[model samples]
Structure formats: C-alpha cells, structure tokens
Target: MAINVELLKKVCEAPGVPGYESKIRNMIIEEVTPLVDDISVDNMGNVIALKKGRSDEKRAMVAAHMDEIGFIVTHIDDKGFVRFTTLGGFDPKTLTAQRVVIHGKEDVIGVMGTKPVHVMTPEEKNKMPKIKDYYIDLGMNKEEVEKLIEVGNPITRERELIEMGNCVNCKSIDNRVSVFILIETLRNLKECPYDVYGVFTVQEEVGIRGANVAAHSINPDFGFGLDTTIAYDLPGASAHEKVTSLGEGTAIKIMDAMTICDYRMVDYMKKIAEENKIKWQPELLTAGGTDTAGIQRMGKSGAISGAVSIPTRHLHQVIEMANKDDIDGSINLLSNCLESLDKYDWSHK
Candidate 1:
C-alpha cells in the first residue's frame, strides 16, 4: 500500500520542539482519536491512546515522540540578530545559510547567518564552525524585531515536505514519520492480543523525558520504540558505516548508545518480520539514542523493548528522507506485531 503523503507532510511540517509540543500533540490527538478505544493527554503533554485487545492480561506500549530538534530564544542582540540555544543535538555545519521560523508573538521567518568565508582569516577558514558562531537574521532592527519576537520563543527549520524518487524529504522526518506510522498502524489494526498504548511522546530529542513518564504510568509488558535511524548509504560511506540504507527496509533495532534491546524482543521482531515477509534490516547505532531507552527501563519491572526504525538520510537536517516502501512496511510490521503478541512464547532462553 502507498503511504499517505499528505498526512505525512502535515506531520513533518508542524513545529513542535522539546518541552513545547502543543501543535503536534493536538494533531496527533485528532488523528488517533477515532482509531483508538480511548485517548487522553497526560500532564507532561504526552498523548496516550488506548486500543483494547482480546485479552487485557498484558499491555504493550509503542512510543513515537512528537518533538523535533529546535532552538529556544535566549538573546536578541542590538542588531536584531537572534541568539538561541539548541534544544537537541545538531551538526553545526547544517545551520549555514538555512531558513528558520521563529515562533514568538507570531510566526516570523529568519535566515541563519554566519561569517562569510571570504572575510575569514587563513586560520579561521580552516576551522570548523560551532553553534555559537551562528545567528538568525530577522532583517529588522532591535526595535522592530522585539515587536514580533522575544526571548523564550522557539525556532524551527523552515522546510516543506516533498516527494523525491519514492522517498519523502522534509524537516522533522526523524520522528514525525514514526508518528504517522503509529497512527496508521492503529487505523489498520484489527485485533490485538494485549491492550496497546500508542503514545506520542514529547522531549525525546532532549532526553527521552516524555517516554519515561508515559512508560512508568502504562507499565507495559512489551514496548516498541518508533523513530528514525541513520541511512549513511552515501558516496563515501564504508559498508560498515552505513548503519542502514534507504529503500532497503525498515530497521529492527538491536542496540544504540543508550539502550540494548531485550534479546527476546529482538528475536520476536525478527521472527514476525520474516513470517510476514516484511522487508527489514538490523540496526546497531553506535551513538544517539531514542525513546527506546525510557520505554525499556522506566516501568516498574521494566519491559521487553525493541524499536522499529525508519532508515533516514540526512537525519537531524531539514532534508531528512525516508523511503515510502520502508514506511509502509513499518506500519504493517507494527500492526501485525501488536495483533500477534499472544502467539509468541516470550520466554527467556
């Protein structure tokens, strides 16, 4: 089945930085409301949707964080330059000459500005740029800028979602694509063996904060983390360095910097994918983590946790891309896994 590009586009373009997710959270609530038996927003702003299963003896929690990497306003210089601190990890080089949207009293567009290479000294030309070296140019003086923007406003990349060669590209695809997958899975699900808690969490880019709170409350027996992983299938990448590849398949997470997936959960996911003939690959990211960490260890006794990772190119940048087939396969795999949980032994070897 073809992925829903329109819905995916809306999800990717929405602005929702860590600690501020009302926009995306509201969209998620609307999308999953009819698909689930019950839904509610928690105090921490995580959107939890419940779909009852045939047997409620065990519960499963699936998390797709709503927040994207962004910046919070810290200072506005006299020249109307916007100085901000990053809310999540970013490659400083990506900020060069990029456009951004500052969400303040009203939405305003600004351009990322940096010292031009032509004016740099020989030593400076050879040095890599840092986050501190960049600022947002609002094209207004301090007086004019203050009317629309101020300290504490959030800023996000300004990019529109576009389809290119069977893949969707846009900002926030790292996690928004996963949010779309979880919503679609819920819409397509038939019967689950255990109650499914589909959670659109917040603050994942910062520290997996929302997932920790949601998982603690749900205390699920099984957990699935839905997020994106690097697809370094570029010209210069070595085979080993290509963590996963675009259009190859959805990735079944083995381990990342912060969490080692439960061996049983990993095995079960692999088995389910094979049984259903769903295309998949193994992912072992050396750095970076996802909500998987929180979902795995936050529960009272901890849950058997693994992740369904979309293979993304140019991750954490405005041009992130993911294949349509991989996205469709993810929705299928997750829906099937939720329905067939009762069939798996889930025993330790």
Candidate 2:
C-alpha cells in the first residue's frame, strides 16, 4: 500500500511542543479515532488505541511519542525581546537565526536574534553560542510585546513540510515518523495475531514521561518503541558512529545510551525483516535514548522491550530529514511483525 504522504505532511507540520500537545493530540485523535477497536487518552494525554487479536494470547505495545522539543516563554524584555526556557534539547549553535512561532495571545512569528559577528571580540568568536545570548525578537516594542505575550507561552520552530527529492524535511520528524507508522499500521491493520496497544504519547521530548505511565497501565508482554535515530552519514563522521544511515531502511536497535535491547527481541525484529526481505539496519546509538528503556523497565518483572527507529539526519533541527524508502521499510516490518507475533517464541525465559 502507498504510505499516506499527505497525512504525513499534515502530521509533521502540526504544532505541538512538549507539555503543550493539544493541537497535535487533537489532530491525532481525529485521524485514529475510527481505526482502532478501543481508544482512550490518559491523564498524561497519551492517546492509547487497542486492536484486538484472534486470541487473548499476549499484549504487544508500540509507542510513538507525539511531542516535539520546543521552548516556553520565560520573560518578555523591555525592548520587545523574548527570553524563554527551552522545553527540550536544542544545540545553541543552531538556535541563532531560526524563525519561530510564539503562541502568545495569538500566534506571533519571531526570529531567534543573536549578536552580529562584526561586533564580537576574538574571544567571543572562538566561544560557543550560549542559550542566554539568544532571544526571540517579535519586532514589537515593550508595551505591545507585554500586551501580546505572557511568561508561559510556548514557542516552536516555524517550518513547513518540504519534500526534498526522495526525502521529507521538517522539524519534529524525530517522533512524528513513528507516529505516522502507528497511524498507518492501525489504518491498514485488519487483524492482529495478538492484542496490540498503539500509544501516541506526550512529553517524550522532556522525558519518556507519557510512555512510562502508559506502560505501567498496560503492563504489556512485549513492547516496541518507535522513534527516529541519528543518521550521521555526513562528510566528516565515521561509518562506525554513523549509527543508521538514511535510505538504508528501518533500524533495529541493539544498543543505545538508555537501554541494551533484549537479545531475543532484537533477534525477533531483525529476523522478521530478513525473512520478509524488508530493508533494515542494526542501530547502535552512542548517545540519547527512546521510550524503549521506559517500557522495558515497567511493572515488577518488567516487559520484553525493543525498538524500531527511522534513520534520520539533523535531528532536533528545523531541517531534520528522513527518507521515504526508510519510512516504508519500517511500516512494512512492523505490520508484518504484528500480524505474525504468535509465530515467534517470545518467551521471557
């Protein structure tokens, strides 16, 4: 089946930052309401959808967080400049010269302003850019700025989905790619070999907070955390640290900074990819983590957990990109895995 590129475009551009996911959440609720057998939103704003299987064999949970890294207004200065506390991770170097949308009284467009290089000293030029050095300039004076914005307004990088050759580029692709996978899986999925929980979680960028709550509630037998991993396949990085490259295919995680995957779970996904001839790569991220860690450690005995990551480039930036083929490959592997869950020996012992 053709992946829903139009639906994906809308999802990617949807406005939702960490702890402020209403716009994205409502959009997701609308898209997925009809596809699943049962669905609910938890206190944490996690959208949980369940599709029943032929038998009550075992529950398999897949998480794709809906939140993106963003900023919240902390101060509106006298000169109409806005200072904010970052809601999630952003390289200060990339913060400068960025166009952003501040959700104040109304949506206001602003640029992250920084000192001009011509006025910098030699010492300042050699130093790294600090978050304190940057502020959102709404181009309004103090009176107008104070009247329009508040101290707690959220701000997000302003970007529209851009199709670049065979790839799609935009912000929030880190988790939105996974969200797309879950939505399409449910839309296309008719029968499951086992009970499936598709969770579109909130606040993953701040922490795996939503997933933590969802996993505890479900106490799944098997868990798959879907997310995007770094594809440092650029000019200067080594292949060893490239993690997973774009266009290669889906990523089967072996290890990352947060969790060492269960061997059987890793083997399970990898084997499925191989048998089905789905393109995939083994991911070994040296840093960062996904909800897989939180899911694996849930309940008293915990659950068998693993991950399927979309190989992506320029993670956390407005220019983040992922290949169409890789997205298709992940969808294929996960749907196939869900349909054939009973076919595998997923015993804990």
Candidate 3:
C-alpha cells in the first residue's frame, strides 16, 4: 500500500518540537495502534509499537523521529517583542519575514522581523543576518504579551503542507515523511520472519536521545533509521557535490558523517531493491547525521544498522520538497527488507 498524501500532510504540519512532541506522538499512536500487536510510550516520550513475527528470537527496529526544528521563548522585551533561542540547527538566512506560532498559554501568532534592506547601509546589507538581530512580534503590549506567553513555551513555523505538481512541500518533512513511510510499511506487512519494532522517536533534532534509549532497551538483531537526506540536485550545485537527486529513488546510505553502514546490511537492501524492481540510489552524505548514528552503537555488541532515505530539497526550511515516487519506493523497499530479515545470516561479517 502507498502512503496517503493527506495523512503525510497532516503529520508534517503537526506541532512537535523536540521535548514538546506530545501532540504528534498522540497522532501517531492513533494511526499505528491497530496495525501493530502492541504500542506504548517511553520515559523520553518515544512511541514504541510492535508487530510480532513468526518467531520471537529475531527482532528488527525501525526508527523515525517525530520532532522538528523550532524555537523557545527566551525573553520578552518591554515593548512585547519576544527574544528566542533555536531548539535545533537553523540558518539565519531563512528566518526573515517567516510566520510562526508561539505555543504559549494560548496559541500566539507572530512574525519574525528584521531591519528593512531599504534603510540599511551597503556594509550592513553585506553582513549576514544574525538570530540575535531578530525578534518575534506578537503585536501586543508588554503587559498583554507577558500575560499570554511564558519564557519556556515552544515556537514553531506556521506553515501548512501544500501539494505542488508532483511534490509535497511543508516545514517538518525532514523526519515526519519517514514516520509516514514506517507506518505504511507495517500496514503492508502481511507476514514477516522476525518481530518488528516501529519506533517514533523524539528529540532527534536536538540530539539522538530517543533512539539511543529505545535501541538499548529493545536490543534488536537489525535496525534501520528512516529519515530524509539532502538533495543538492538543484540549480547552482555541482554534479559531484549533489548528495542525491530528487525523483531518482529512495536513497540507501553507504556512509554519512555520523554512521558507517554495515556492508552486509547495505548489500541486503540493494539486493532486495533489485529483486523487487524498486528504484534506489546509493547515498554518501558529507555532513549531517540521523538516528542511525545512535542506534548502530547501542546495546551489547549492537545490531547491524543502515538507513533508507527519501531525497528532500531545502531540508529544515519551511518549503521542504519531496517526490511522491520516492516516498512510495521507500515503503516498498522497507517492507520487503523486513520480510526477508530472518533469512539472512546477520552474525556474519
């Protein structure tokens, strides 16, 4: 079965930033509960769902993070402007004039404002904008703003998912798209050899906190991190530097900054793709990491780990784009991999 675009849109637009993932976690639990044999949330707020296999010995863990990059209220100025700190990695260039939702006592709408270019000097224009130079304007007086918002409330980009041509664009597609894929795969698994653990992790944007704990607890024989990878296949990018191209296929990571994929697992994925005629590309990311980095080293001796990535453009930005075919292909490949896991000799190097 293919991923439902409407469901994908909802998951991408849900408000969940790192530690503040209760909303998104609850949504996932509702959709995934019936398909899996059991499900529960852990202390770190990671949602762990299970689908029992024919045998109980071999287990496979598939993880996709639910948190997205956002901000937290740091200080409220006398004039009611809110100063904030980023909760995850962000480019200052992408902050100007963006709409945001401050999850205060009540939802507060705000806009990120900066000095107008018309009033700036050439030197000022040449210098890059800094996060410190910007503040969220709620258009309220100091007293009113103070009454409505606290210093610790989370703030997220206020953008809804839109379908453009053959792609889907949204703010939090970085890993929510992966979550959709994992859920769809489990729904499509008619029969499998090993027990499957579908984990929707939290705090991955800040650090791989949820995956670390989940992996250590489950101790699966194999693991896969489902997440998005940068697709630098746009204008102004050199051919060799493009990490992976959009619409090509789902990416199979050879190695990335955080994790070196197990050779046997990589080969296993490739073989399954070829046998099933699913489109795929080999990925080698120069920078950035995913939950795979944390899962590959968790528990006793660890499990052989690898990742299946969707090609995404403008990742971590409001208008992230991904192809429909790539999303469908990833679901097929992951489901096939789960069905054939017990057939492989995982202990072999």
Write down the RMSD of all candidates, one decimal each: 0.8, 1.2, 1.1
User: Top lDDT: which candidate number?
Assistant: 1
lDDT of each: 0.94, 0.89, 0.92
Worst 10 residues of 1 by lDDT: 313-322
What stretches of model 2 exceed 4 Å from their correct place?
A: none
* Model 3 stretches astray by more than 4 angstroms: 347-349
lDDT leaderboard ranking? 1, 3, 2
List runs of model 1 lying over 4 Å from the truth: none
Candidate 1's residue-wise lDDT over 102-162, tens digit each? Answer: 9998899999999999999999998899999999999999999999998999999999999
What does candidate 3's lDDT look like per residue over 202-253, in tens digits? 9999889999999999988889999999999989999898999988999999
lDDT of 2 at 282: 94
Question: What digit string (tens of lDDT, one per residue) describes model 2 on residues 1-349?
Answer: 4567898889988888988999999999999989998999999999999999997767889999999999999988778899988888888898888899998789999999889999999999999998889998898998988887999999988888888998988888978888999999888776887899999999988889999999999988888999999999999998687988988989999988998999988988988999999999999988889999878887456778889999999997766999999999989888888888778887756
